[model samples]
Target: MMTCIVIDDEPLARSLLAQHIADVPFLEHRGSFKNALLAADFLSKNQVDVLFLDIQMPKLTGIDFLKSLQHPPKVIFTTAYREYAVESYELQAHDYLLKPITFERFFTAVSRLQVATPKVIETPIPETATTPEHIFVHVNKKHIKVILEDVTYIESIKDYLKIHTTKETLVIKERISHFIEQLPNPPFIRVHRSYIVNRDHITAFTQQDIEIGDIEIPIGGTYKEEVLNILKAP
Candidate 1:
C-alpha cells in the first residue's frame, strides 16, 4: 500500500478529503495535520509516497513547502482558487486536485501514481511452486545461487546493495530502490535509512534498535510505527 498524508486547515476540508481517500482501496492515511511545519517534520521522519497539500496555509504556502524539500514525492495540490494550477505543475506535482475534491478527480491522480510506480517480473519454478527457495543473480561473470532464506539483509551503497548472505556479500551494481523490486516481501522489511532485514533473522530488538547476529541495526525514526506494528502483528 502507498502511505499518504493530508495537509489542510479546515475541518470540513479534511472531512471531505478523508472520505475521498477512504474510497481508494490502496491508500491509508498516516495522519493529518493543520500546520506545514508539523507536516514537514512528519515527512522527514516517515516514508510517504503521496502528499495531498493545500496551498493557502498561514505560515507556509504549499508551493513554498514543496520547494524546500530535498526529495519531494508525488504531490496533489488542493485549494479553492485555480491561479496556482500552472505553477503547481511547474513544481512537478502529479495532479492538482481542487478543493471539495471529487472522487473521480482523486482516482485520476492515484492512477497517475500507478503509472509512475516501478515494475517487476516474477517467474515460477516447477517443484518450488509453493516454496521457491533460490534465485539467480549475475555477479562477477557467473550466475550465483542465492538461497533467499539465507540472506540476512541488503544494504544500498548508492547504486547497488552489498547483498549480505550467510556465506558472502556480493556487490552487484543495480538500482537500490529498483533492485528492491526483486526481493520477496513479508520475511523481509526495509527497516532503516539504507537497509532491509530478513525479519525472521531478527535475534532481538528494542524501541531504538534491532539485533541480527552481531549487527545492531538502528531503525529510521519515521519507520518506527510500521516496524512496531509489524512486530506486534500475528
Candidate 2:
C-alpha cells in the first residue's frame, strides 16, 4: 500500500483530498496539513509515496515547497490556477488537477502512482446499445447540446475553453484537458497544449502544424510524433 498525505491551506480542500485518499484502496492516508511548512516536518519524519499538494498556500507555495525538497515524493498539484501548469510539469509532477475536483478526475490522477500506462475505466456496453452522439456543456447560464460530429476544434483560453463547431463557437468555463475527457478519442485528438482538433475536420497538416479549413493550429513539440502517427493511420 502507498502512504499519502494532503497539504493545502484551505481546511475544506485538505479534508476533501484526505477523503479521496481514503476511497482509493491502495492509498493509505497518513495525515493532512493546512500548510506546506507543516508537511515539511512530517516528510522529514515519515515515508510518503504521494502528496496531494495545493499551489496557492499562505506561507510557501506548492511549487517552491517541491523545489526545496531534496528527495520529494510523487506530487499531484491541486489548484484553481492554470498559469502554473508548465512549471508544475517541468518539476515532473505526477498530475495537475484544477479546483472543485470530481471523484472521477481525482481517481485518474492517483491511479497513475500504481500503473505506468493508465487507462480510462470503461463501462461494459450491451451489443445493441450505441455510444453517445452528443454532449451537454454548461454555456452562458444553461446546458448547451453539442453534437460530436459538429465540433471542429477546441481552444484553451486561460481557465475557459472555446469550443468551435460547424454552426457556432460556444464559450465555456472549463479546463481543456477535463473537457476532452468527455469526448471520444479517434474523432477528437489533442494536437497541442492549447488545442484539440477533430481529425475529420482536418483539411491539411505539416510536421509543425495542422490546418482545419482556414485556421491552422500548431502541433506541440512533445505531442508531434503521436499526433502525426494518429493522422497518418488508416
Candidate 3:
C-alpha cells in the first residue's frame, strides 16, 4: 500500500481527502495536518509515498513547503486556485487537483502514478556513452544479428514486429508489447498504433507524417503531443 499524508488548513478539505484515500485500496492515509510544519514532522518520523498538498495555507504555502524539502515524495497538489497548474508540473508533481476533487479525478491521478512509478530492474543496463548500437533478435527461430544504426523503424504486425534495417526489414516473432519495453528510449518512440521510429533518422515531420530515410509513416493522433515534444528536444 502507498502510505499517504494530507496537508490542508481547512478541516473539510482534510476530511474529503481522507475519505478519498479510503476508497483507493492501495493507499493508506497516515494523518492529516493543518499546516506544512506538522506534515514535515510526520514525514521525518515515518515513510510516505504520496503527499496530498494544498497550495494556500496561513504561514507557508504548499509550494514553498514542498520546495523546502530536500527529498519530497510524489505530490498531488490540491488547491482552489488554477494558476498553480504549470508551477506544480514544473516541480514534477504526480498530479494537480483543483479543490473539491472528485473520486474520478483522484482515481485517474492514482492510475497515472502507477505508470510513472520508478522500478529498479534487476538486469541493469551496461554503462556506456551511447544506447546499444548492436543487438541480436531471433527471427523465424533463427538468431539474427542486427545493427541498431541501420534500423529505420519498427512496425507491429499483429503479435509480431518487423524491424526495418537499411538493408532489410527483418520479421521478428517476438511480441510487440515486450519488444517495445526492451527498445531504448528517445531515438526510438512509438508514433502510431503499429509504428515506432528512430528520431535521429527522421528527415521531416508534419501534422500527418514523419519522414525516415525515403519512407514516410503516418503519426497517430494520440501520440502526436509526445512525439512533438520528443522531436523538439534537440
Candidate 4:
C-alpha cells in the first residue's frame, strides 16, 4: 500500500482527492492540508510514498515546497493550470493532473506511481554472473517482461518512455535513466538525449546519425565521438 497526502488550498479539491484516495485499494490517504507549509511540517514527522500537491497556494506554492525538500516523495501535481506541466516534469514529478481530476485520470497517475516505485529483491546476487539480458517494465499497471536484445530503441515523451522492440512498442511512465541503468553496455547506447538505440540493431551509421531497421536516429553532439568509436571498434 502507498501512503499519500493531499496538499491543496481548495476544500472541494481536497475532499475530492480524499474520496479518490479512499476509492483506490492500494492508496492510503494520510491527511490533507490547505497549504504547502502545513504539508511540509507534517512530512517532517511522517513517511509518505506519494504526494498529491496543488501548484498555486498562499504562503508557499507547491513547486517551491517540493524544491525545499532534500528528498521529496513521488509527487503528482494537482492544479488547474496547464502551463505548469513542463515545469512539473522538470522537477521529476511522478505525474501531473489538471484540476477537475476524474477518477480514471487519478487512477492512471496512481498506477504509474506503483510501477515506478522501486521494489527490493530479497534474493542474493551471484558476483560472477553478468547482468540480466531482459527487464520487466510496468505498463498499464501490469509488469511486462522485455528482452533487451529485441529492443530497437527507446524514446522519451514528456513523463513517459516509448520502448520500441522488434515485436511491439511499450509505453510506460518512467525515465530514460532508469532503462540505462538496466540495459547492459555494448548493445545499448544513448545516441541522443531523447533516444537510446540498441547497437546490435543498427543497420548503418554516420557521424551525425545511426540507421536501425529503416529508422534514422540523430546522434547528439556529446555522444558523436563515443558512438563512432563504439561502432568502428574492431
lDDT of 4 by residue, 42-74 (tens): 989998999999999998999999989988988
User: What local lDDT score does residue 215 receive in model 2, on the 0 to 100 scale?
Assistant: 98
Identify the leading candidate in terms of TM-score.
4
Q: State residue 100's C-alpha deviation in candidate 3, in Å.
A: 1.2
For all predicted structures, in order, the TM-scores are 0.51, 0.59, 0.55, 0.64
For candidate 3, lDDT tens digit of each residue in 152-233?
8998875578899889988877544346555678668888867889887899998888998679999877578878888877
Better of 1 and 4 by lDDT: 4
**Against the unseen true structure, what C-alpha lDDT does each candidate score?**
0.79, 0.86, 0.83, 0.87
Consecutive 10-residue window with the lowest summed lDDT within model 1: 174-183
Q: What RMSD does model 4 have?
A: 6.8
Return the top candidate by lDDT. 4
Better of 1 and 2 by lDDT: 2
Least well predicted 10-residue stretch by lDDT in candidate 3: 174-183
Please give the ranking of all candidate structures by TM-score, highest first, separated by commas. 4, 2, 3, 1
Candidate 2 vs 4: which has more lDDT: 4
Candidate 3 achieves a global lDDT of: 0.83
